[model samples]
Target: MMLFQHHNTGIHLDSGSTFHLRTNEDDFKEGSLQGIHGGFHYASNVKGRELYQEGIDKVFDSVCKLDTRASDNVNSLSNMVQDGFDVFMDTNRENSFFVTRNGTTWRFGHHCRVPQKAED
Candidate 1:
């Protein structure tokens, strides 16, 4: 599990599975892992609301892409997003949720129960 936090914003990653060794037969000499399951949460003051919401929108978009590509399985990417949220919030059930990818490029998605307030 990896956790990164700065002030009221934080990210938590839980690599659920182990890395598998890949041989030349698979075209790679080194081993590779699949992906991560995690969640992100942020709280900002009123002054930072616009920027924070923009960030949240980006995350939400990424998750939607992952969900579309994910298969119907317990360990699917969408599930990973939810799992990450559960872990980060330390709750067994749902809360405000966001999904993000790791590495050089990043993407995100969103799932939230509460209605977002209108922009000023």
Candidate 2:
């Protein structure tokens, strides 16, 4: 999903990186997840739908147990992953920046480059 930079709000972690992503509900919700189903290993099988539903159930159950709130974090990213989305790092820029998944490019804040590294 595309994460637009917020106008002002920012989050600073212990690593000194600052994430200034837009918290607006729509910013991270405008994307399609159908690609995930198509890429699944069992997508061509007769039981593909059942397999996908089962996988989704497991992930949804896990997410429900997390304390993180969609309003305050990159919850959409997790949701995307659970649905079988694969994120691709943007390589066109010299500096660490946005990343893409499916057809959406998620732009990041000045310090919100690599999500994992930013957490550290």
Candidate 3:
């Protein structure tokens, strides 16, 4: 959501224009884990559910304010937040979401976390 706020038009970082750097899945998931790891809520708890809904609402409201014309579709900021949250909660380390100057493009990708073993 913050990325869209800064780069609503989605320009490439190397285009000589300033834009937020993309976050890989590993880093993003790790950060999110660190943020909520101390919490005592699991998926079945009322507090966990409340916190989840609160986060969704906050993201929705923020996106609405930042991108006035966006909607709950793939091309909209709100949906991006929704999907990102889902992926994060699922601990999906293989998928990453990013935007490009070309437009809002959500692509599935993988981040290599281990070095390849060469055959002897």
Candidate 4:
């Protein structure tokens, strides 16, 4: 499994198969998953169709749960930034950042700076 972002949207790809999840709803509306059945058609032939469906279902469930947690983390970070926290990107690690809030520090990866709170 690999997680990455494109055009400011998160994507989770299963390396074993062509199955993937997109964070943006628009990606689905735009038919990003249109040809997915065709890609996995052979899997049903090799494995029973029921087994293939079950495996895909499991992967889909896991991906959905992961995406939910990621979204929650992002929201929490955004709130912190709004409440005067500062996030500095970590140069040593890709997609990592140092988040400081009221002198308490935490590190998180797969996210960078959150938008600053608007002035009154």
Candidate 5:
């Protein structure tokens, strides 16, 4: 599955890494994951996904200065592991992003990349 990284946002992380990306638009797909599927023994995308998510958060924090502390990023993320989706990651487990069981739905956690906050 192809993942669409958001461009045109000029997103910059606090670590100074610019969010550089591109898409076919006509053939672009978006999701929360990347890398190889390691069954249960491997979970690379999970960590990589976290870093990607963190980078995104840093970008938002940097570009918008919305450095609000998350009360349960880990808990929410942990729960997602049970959703039965297949997760993939790089060899180093740095970008262990998520991929759906159908091999279609890809993207960072909905909460991680999405800009809107649900109402309390």
Candidate 6:
């Protein structure tokens, strides 16, 4: 699959943005795969989730960040390192999600939760 990052928004690139150039958001629709979003978690915690989300977000999966135009979200994210998330700092926003088309099927990253497997 092709891998790259959006120039402006800095969102991760995947097979979805096959022909995209500018990246304020996944504004251009590249078939049905344009909306595949959030499939992983940051240690399943806020900080871990946020950075990890940011790490690969803009370059496998296509996810966005919805937060303060200034500082609130960043500050909140900092607190999450120690105290974890409060009521307001709920997991990332759904708006940052993405949709993508893969062949005859559509793959949604955020929508597809990683499977749970228990082992001894």
Candidate achieving the largest lDDT: 4
lDDT of 2 at 50: 21
Model 1 misplaced stretches (Cα beyond 4 Å): 1-57, 61-86, 91-112, 115-120
Q: How would you encode candidate 6's per-residue C-alpha lDDT over 4-68 as one tens digit per residue?
A: 23233332223322112222233323332332255333221234322211211222232233222
lDDT by residue (10-101, candidate 5, tens digit) is 22111122222212121123342233233212122223221212111221121111111221121123323454545454546333354444
Candidate 2's TM-score reads 0.26
Query: What TM-score does candidate 3 reach?
Result: 0.17
Off by over 4 Å in 5: 5-75, 91-96, 109-120
**Per-residue alpha-carbon lDDT of candidate 3 for residues 16-70, written as tens digits (9 for 90 to 100):** 2121122222222222322223332222212222111111111112121111122
Which 10 residues in a row give candidate 4 its minimum summed lDDT? Answer: 51-60
Compared with the true structure, the alpha-carbon lDDT of candidate 5 equals: 0.28
Task: Report lDDT (CA) for all predictions.
Answer: 0.24, 0.30, 0.24, 0.32, 0.28, 0.25
Writing each residue's lDDT as its tens digit, candidate 1 over 28-82 gives 2223212333422322232211111111112212221111111211123334545
Pick by TM-score: 4 or 6, better one = 4
lDDT of 4 by residue, 14-44 (tens): 2233323333333333222222333333232
Ranking by TM-score: 4, 2, 5, 3, 6, 1
Candidate 1 local lDDT, residue 81: 49
Stretches > 4 Å off in candidate 6: 1-29, 32-38, 43-46, 50-120
Clashing residue pairs in candidate 2, if any? none
Which ten residues in a row are the worst by lDDT in model 3?
50-59
lDDT at 28 for candidate 6?
A: 26
What ranges in model 4 sit over 4 Å off? 1-76, 92-94, 111-120
Q: What TM-score fits each model?
A: 0.15, 0.26, 0.17, 0.27, 0.26, 0.16
Candidates arranged by lDDT, highest first:
4, 2, 5, 6, 3, 1
Q: What is the lDDT of residue 97 in candidate 3?
A: 40
